[model samples]
Target: MLPVAAQQNLPVATAQTQNIKRIPLQRFEVPGTAYETVIGIAEIGPNVSIGRHTHPGPESGYVIEGGFELLVEGEPPRMLKAGESYKISPHTIHDAKTGADGAKVIATYVVEKGQPLAAAVK
Candidate 1:
């Protein structure tokens, strides 16, 4: 058996840093409707592009770190840095690319029941 002092000196397990971390914050179902509100955070890696995608509902997000280049259908691309925010309409095609130092964002969405949070745009 290991001594108590020896056990106390052992390395502790810790969560490793990752390129991206999606943390769900909250979810609320609309009363008597097929809709729900979801909130979460997205941590992106440096120089990463999330790729073109669409949501089944409206989405709003605020930049928390570094910056992002956002491209949405029918509009010119825009750069959003920390403390900045954006809103995306339902079914609007868009893509988010992170800057050199990477980025973190807090996002919220009002979506339909059973639909995916995001769908890739072909």
Candidate 2:
């Protein structure tokens, strides 16, 4: 186990961390495919920033409350407000930073089974 101080600085979605709560809702295998679908809710505290990362496949999400700035490599940042939805292609590096009100989002990912759900990008 990591020391309390180190744990406190972990990446937003890594194991667990301050300012962000990731709740895994479900994971199921896709019929006739080698991929699986994962659903979860990400609650980000005010001013929290989730660094760039990527999944083995695609990730789609809906803003459930408040909003954030979605930054993807080579693209302009997009502000996703409540009630909006967005999708990122496989392995596309991206990150999100919440505004003062923070944000809550439900995300769905279609990824290869047995692979890490997310990987931080340099």
Number of the top candidate by TM-score? 2
Clash pairs for candidate 1: none
lDDT of each: 0.74, 0.77
- Using all chains and alpha carbons, the TM-scores for the candidates as numbered come to 0.82, 0.86
- Per-residue lDDT tens digits for candidate 2, residues 6-93, read 2232245553256776676777899999998878787888887787777778889999999999998889999999999999999888
Model 1 error, position 84 (Å): 0.8
Model 2 residue runs over 4 Å out of place are 1-16
TM-score of 2: 0.86
Worst 10 residues of 1 by lDDT: 1-10
- Give lDDT tens digits, candidate 1, residues 43-105: 777877776777788989999889989999899999999999999999898887787898889
